[model samples]
Target: MAAIPAPLSHTVAAIDAAYVAAARNGDSLGVSMSQVIHPCDRALFYQFRWCAAPEPATGQRQRIFETGNVYERRLLDMLRMIGCDVFEIDETTGKQFRVELAGGHIRGKMDAVATGLPEAPETPHVVETKSANDKSFKAIVKGPVRETKPEHHAQLQLYMHAEGLRRGLYLVVNKNTDEIHAERVEYDPAFCLAIIARIERIVALDAPPARLHDDPTKKGAVECMFCSARAVV
Candidate 1:
């Protein structure tokens, strides 16, 4: 391998920095299933209602998110090539299936509601796709999502319930090795109801909920380190 010149490296760095800045500004209307299933209520409230400040993503974080989308697109194509009919858009409306709750204050654009798969060829499946690094991939394969990743489990449950689907296929692609893992998630109505109840409570609040930890200003607080509401500044 040859080392790049300093000028070329600096030029590419500047372009990435500009792209990250532009990507950081987006106008989200309401709470998506991703935040609802997460652990921190304060972070959820802050992001959903745009009350507290949020630090924008770094160039590296933006690149990581974009890479995951690339993985998802490639996997969807492979499934289609293998004879599975993946429906990313509605047949009539030509839009991804949209679910709105709480009078459109809470919503999600479902990834896909797919049909004609080898697992459940007769019934439509809510397809929840993810890409994981090696350690997380190993944990995901070892146990039910209830133990390994409850947030993602709840996310699938909510989507399936909203779509009136009784079954779903959870797909994970390992980034390190390109290994694929799949799980079938049966719909749970109770879980969906609970999640919806919480969303309503959070959104209806006058102010943001308490921080995930008692003293988020502390240097070593557990929640401060993890909460998205804790901005870099």
Candidate 2:
């Protein structure tokens, strides 16, 4: 019998092969993998990713609203003032930068990613912003001080991981209060490695994970609220 390949080696090779095939076919490797691992989830993920970006359908409406709203505007201006280069990722472009996850997959577009600023004597900051209703915004602000939400942390971590950054900055605003708070966060190599491992597990799974919840409740809230899955789920 042939010896089995190591798990890491197998996964890396799978990813590489998938990417090669996708490139040759002029398709997205991430999208191709999504078809293999979780077709339903990928469809939803694709929608949410684009909705958050600059799109013709929205006609830059999202940015307009964000700038018009007091709190959001302030946060946006502040981010820009800090020299953050804001950009959007459409669904098509997003698929090219996919990362696999356990029992499923995870992908993101950098809302506003900045680099080339002089590195601080201290760790650099990776900032993420969110706009939410009054009640939910307050709840998040008051929630147990756990650095930032793990999911947001994960999001920023992925950005940082991709950009080779070590530190992060987070700005969360309350639409009602027009208040903006900032926090500094450091990178956790362990957490990133765990996320990568989870992605590997997701890809290796025989079936997709359960459909994600689409409510504002704790467990159900994070991934789905802003996801395209909400529409169909």
Candidate 3:
């Protein structure tokens, strides 16, 4: 088994410190850390839901959507079961770490960061947990797995870039079967540029794009089911 890279250890410490700071502020720093460390295709899917339609529906759909979180928790449990060191970072500091992403950087107090099972010590793997979002998950795994997504790869690539890591592991859990699917991804600069272009367009526009509906009339839309914006819309 290959040893965990020294640089990756430093990166993990930096990331953990950021999360610790963010949690202290009662913010979504953990969520952002989810993006940096895991960089799964589903993360982009949620971002799309947030940007396209902030509000969708409720009731049973909401329950189904809530399974995403449950699956993530279960996946974390599984990792712990396998003896991985899993830490919850501070949410507020997490946000600051994300802000650094815009400029292609990562900053935090900790050093000697590491990922994967410390006991096993193979090629480092960062596991991303997802629930029932098969489409996005497949898209990421389909080809030679690249670091970026068509729309938001920049954020993911930025994470890998900052960490000085080249590979990632994506773990997708099926809600119905409770089966865990795994895939390997490698970093690619071309793919990263494509995703960066998409984000740039979103940021440069005077108003939010029309295709990204903040509120849709569709009753069964996934975005409506669990979005925090559901109440206001």
Candidate 4:
């Protein structure tokens, strides 16, 4: 038999759809570090400089995102289970570590602020977790994170710089094998400054910046097929 279907925007009842609707509506908020390191500068600019937002994430995409949250929590437990000290929850307000930039136009939360891990032993490091399928896991292991996914690498650097941490412990789990890959990321002041400048420029712009790629008709580019800001380009 086929597996049960995840709820769709139209098919679900009001009670069932409420949470999903809230999650979708939340995307209408500000930018995050995830977009900072994207190869397409114009896409980032368009997103922050008053261009229209994309369609709400699809049900499958939402489920995949939700699954990543579950994996993050599980990884946190594994770290604490192995005798590491984790400070993901604050005792006072019971919220995770959050940092805002450009007066809260951009923000990102730490997966966990941890210490006493076997890898980084004694330093309080920003802990970022990720789960990827077999192929992407292998690629991440085979190359430096800055090379594999500049976005993740840049986000880590920003987290470390903003949080006053010198380094970070980047963690990734292979979804297919449950295997883990760990990398230590050091803060790069030059890179962080550049990213901050880029963000400021985008926010100050009255019109969308130039497109990173030419018109879709100019070159049969693949990114245009998936771009939400294409119309604004």
Each candidate: what lDDT?
0.79, 0.51, 0.46, 0.78
- Summed over model 3, clashes come to 21
Model 1, position 91: C-alpha lDDT score? 76
Q: Which residue pairs show backbone clashes in model 1?
A: none
| Cα error, candidate 3, residue 41 (Å) | 19
Model 2 worst lDDT window (10 residues): 25-34
RMSD of each: 4.0, 17.7, 15.7, 4.3
| 118-202: candidate 4 lDDT, tens digit per residue | 8667888888899999999999997689899788898888888788888888899999999999888888989988888778777
- lDDT (10s digit) by residue, model 2, range 153-231: 6676766665577876666876667676566566777777765665555545554456654344567356555544445
Q: Pick the candidate with the highest TM-score.
A: 4
Candidate 3 segments exceeding 4 Å error: 1-53, 88-100, 103-114, 117-123, 133-158, 206-233
Q: RMSD of candidate 4 to the true fold? A: 4.3
TM-score of each: 0.84, 0.49, 0.48, 0.85
Q: For candidate 4, give the lDDT.
A: 0.78
lDDT of 3 by residue, 86-138 (tens): 54343556522232333332222211122565433565543445566556555
In candidate 2, stretches whose alpha carbon ends up further than 4 angstroms from where it belongs are 1-74, 82-105, 114-123, 143-148, 208-233
Model 2 pairs in collision: 100-199, 101-199, 102-198, 102-199, 102-202, 103-202, 126-168, 126-169
Candidate 4 TM-score over all chains jointly: 0.85
| Model 1 C-alpha lDDT per residue in residues 1-233, reported as the tens digit of each score | 89876565777788689768767544578787666776777777777867655556677778888899999877777778878888888777888778776666567767787778886788888988889999999999996876787877877888888788998888889999999988888999887887788888888888778766676767768767766657722
